[model samples]
Target chain A: MNKRTVLWTAIVLALLALLVLGCVFFGLFEKSVVAKDVDQPLSPEQMKTLAVRGAYVAVAADCYACHTAKGGAPWAGGLPFTTPFGTIYATNISPDKEHGIGNWTRAEFHRAVRDGVGKGDTHLYPAMPYASYRLMTAEDVDAVYAYLMSRPPMKVANKPNDLNFPFNIRRVLTFWNLVNLPADMPPLDAARLEIWNRGRYVVDALGHCGECHTPRNIMQGMKASEYLKGAVLEGVVAPDITKDGLARMGFDPVLLPAFMKSGISAQGAMTNQMFEVVHFSTQYMTGEDLAALSAYLFDLDKLPDKPASPTQPKPVAVAPELATAARGNYLALCSGCHGIEGQGIPHVVVPLSTNASLRLASARNLIHTVLNGIPGQHFPGLERMQPMPGFKDQLDDRQVADLANWLRAEWGGETPSAKAEDVAAIRRDE
Target chain B: MTIALKKLSLTVNGKAVDPVDVPDTMMMQDFLYEYLNLTGARMGCGQGICHACTVIVENDDGTLAEMRTCITGAHWFEGRKVRTIEGHAKRDASGAITQLSPVQQAFIEHFSFQCGYCTPGFVTGATVLLDELKRQPVARADLERAISEALDKHICRCTGYVRYYEAVRDVILNTPGLIKA
Candidate 1:
């Protein structure tokens, strides 16, 4: 009786081990991402059509902005992305046989983009925004691949990432995927309008706006609840694009795409890092798709209550000495381009009264922008904003602090608390 | 709309002008043309993109900076010293031009200005470059680049940049101690 019982127990343990190994191999019955057919060599006409479609898809996905380094060949990939951990340089994706994805099979490429897994099952860092890209259809991603592969092959080597310890470990990213990547794109809300559903997909899958706009959790994964609520990057806040956030910035659904296409409006000019977005992605998007994006941002994110107008901050009283000095300084320095009343000149300067930079809780962006003047941007059309001269050379830290204090207190309803030391710290680039 | 007014006083052409109330928003270019009757600093692009309206502001550090008067209010120069194009030449007691400055002479000899509208900014910019060179000389190889950078912000509709640039180059080559060995 004892021998039979031991043999049965051994048999059960063997079956359990096999089941575990099978699950590991099959990834829990998940379909093989690359098993489907790769397109055969296309005819001249087919290649032309595919390439054109792929170019559009690439623009929609914003592949050019992140992949290409400044002044580097398009898609040659040396752009460095700074994170809390360290700087992660983009990989060369050109069809260069030695240094790029020329050797990768369609399956490998699809799996890398769709699942954030590189060749040999290596986990890729979230810097690639695969969590969002996974929502993209295989056809769209493959179209981008085809277009990128057709581009001139650049032998540019991918720079090694300068990430800090623990983050340098690639295996750590698997946990990031587990927590961040949704199991499946949430089932389409049938109850919503068709355009609304399309807009949701446009924003989440193609745009991936949340990657930068959403605040990251402790793990550095985007906090889904705060989707597009805005987060600060490179010193400036990527202002909230949530329904109410957009409203406060004076953008309704209809005006959203217009602002995007034009890059300048009464609200603010998109000539900052946002210029890069409009330059590559949204500018080329179809009007319908842009409308879809706006629809999703403004309507899908509607608040349950308090759709009231963004309450203006009551002007806080500044110290008489500081107020007088700052007002005079503003008249002499800033009033020329930005109107005497902060009304701003059209076709040249954005109105300071409605600017999002002045209304932020921290004056980091305001200080940075004032210290480092924004270069006048030229859009695709006859659109341009005249450059605002930085007064850093003309004014000292005390003066900048005072100006910031005045801008905040007068316009932002914030108290005058910007100290000379704060401006000095930011000026020192701390 | 009634314009705000501010009392402005500044040293123009090395003379301390009497304090006078001006429209708070009056640009320095307008102040030069309207208040002082010194109209040599022409306003090319009132938005300040073109440097034809540049005026020299002597900083506290003794470094001369070319500030655009088209976008800078007259009040900006309060308690500060400034020089317009008229300040460059030696004037007689009768207010007649007696001696042209080296930069002005170089421009005339090179025939740098056909319309003569942009000549003032060129003079101001070249003077600023000369002032900068006097303080800290540039390497001989860097002299051309320095000159190019100094006048790069200006525009000439007549397209006479080559002659003007060459004239500035001749001045740098002819001047002493401005070029490092």
Candidate 2:
């Protein structure tokens, strides 16, 4: 070939090599700096405001529930998290220079908090919840960092995370990040109402309720199509708070903020992990924030439908023994609040006929709730809420079993009888 | 590998426990089951749904409340007093359980428990209910409602929840001045 043609071919190949190299570097971007640097020293007044704002943002995000170990110093970490993979302990987020994030620059901290990338370019496991945090605004991230930095740093080293096989490899998270998290926040809907926007920010960004409430795909990423429809969490049913689900449960949307804040309303009391979430997180939230959350959940009523399972299961047949026991119990003990026809008294008691928990396959929650009896007022309006009493003293295990089975059968729609042994097991286990 | 420790001191089942170092992550269930060897508070649903892990806590105002041991930390009970099922019986000089508490006796009479794992929590909860009822006696007409309200929160997969109410009612009816005349 002529000399000119040969040189042109070489140039084209060289350009191609540069392009491939650029893509590879971008793919491994976690190794390089990503956060924008903030080098200015703020005045005391500015620091105070920033710190205070950060505290609010932290509460909005419910950081303490995951970051702080029970009875441990706030943000000192060591909260044991059990995942399908293995146990991964939360890290110390206090401002200790040696053991915590004391030395982290704003840029570095931002990336870690927003992108799930830790110091030294390490990919943080999803347990840190950067996936949801990624939706946060830059200002919100900054305020949270400032608040966290203001905390007294206790020298607590993070326990090494115990994960199995390829999960232990931090690099695998890069792919998961690519599939689940977007690098930039979705464009704002300028036309949306202010409260709707605020609610969206809290539900989709700060609160990260979807992490547990939203059903997961095979890869453990959220199934966005079925957003807020409902999912199982830690062997307990996290009921669908979606507009339709809430409507089905007869939950008053207008009263939701109160319910979120206090764990009680005219409907019923919160139980299981919800009880814990209300106790640990929502209890500390501002009324406005809770209102925003309720707003978002209420607005979800108009979302487009997707292929999804029924929010609850259909009922099965009941055992004669359970039905007989339930009949007697219903007349004597339960009828006061629940009513003889299983029609619950309005504003005072939740109806068993349409309740969500009764239709579930496992009787553990039913047994657990019956044995424990509802106690404590996480919110103010709980005084107006109806009370459920424990029968552990007066009822035999067999009778309790029959009652649960009967409730499921009659009101719950043809449901299977709860075995006495199962009740006995739950009673024994918890 | 060493984690920070905290000092915990509390009265358990009427016995004062000296201050001891406990890991902050140590749950109340672990404290009762492992440290103090008070196994009555069984861990059912570690997340606080099942009241099987419940223990009776006395407030400063002399009111009693029930708490879940599985989710609560041992340190949360520091400087507080609590009672478990193991404490529900009067002991002789030889440390033998001589006489069962009224709640326990009623539970026995009603056959309230099956596996008995959740019995301690129930017993504590019922004991608290009885105390509250004693402080403010309810009208005879309100007796069923009050008893249902007190016991509905405690779960029993056995006995269909009827007998427990019957037993508590029996106690109230038999005990003079428990219900308004």
What does each candidate score in C-alpha RMSD?
5.8, 18.6
Per-residue alpha-carbon lDDT of model 2 for A1-430, expressed as tens digits?
Answer: 9999999999999999877655543555343223444445445676678898888888878888878898888898999999889999988899999989988877778778788777777788888878888888878887888898899998889889999998998767876776777556667667776667788888888988888878888888888898887787765557677877675555555667777887764346677667767777787788777777776787842222232333333555665665655665554455545654555765456666666566554566677777766654334444333457676754678888888877776655535657778777667753
Estimate, for each residue in A1-430, the C-alpha lDDT of model 1 and write its tens digit. 6999999999999999988656644445433334356534445565456777899988988988988999987788899988889999988888888888888766677778878887777767888988888888767876877787788889898899999998897866655666677654677888887667878878888888988889989898889888899997776678788888877566667667777777876667885678999998888888878878887888853323323344465788998999888887887778778887788887888888767677666787788878887888887588788877777887899999999999888877777777899888888876
Task: Give all TM-scores, in the order shown.
Answer: 0.87, 0.58
Worst 10 residues of 1 chain A by lDDT: A301-310
lDDT of 2 by residue, B114-143 (tens): 777667777887788888988898899999
Question: Which portions of model 2 show Cα errors greater than 4 Å?
Answer: A1-45, A300-322, A329-430, B1-181
- Fnat of candidates, each listed: 0.63, 0.00
TM-scores for chain A over all candidates: 0.82, 0.75
Q: Candidate 2, which CAPRI tier?
A: incorrect
Pick out the ten consecutive residues of candidate 2 chain A with the lowest summed lDDT.
A301-310
DockQ (C-alpha based) per candidate is 0.55, 0.02
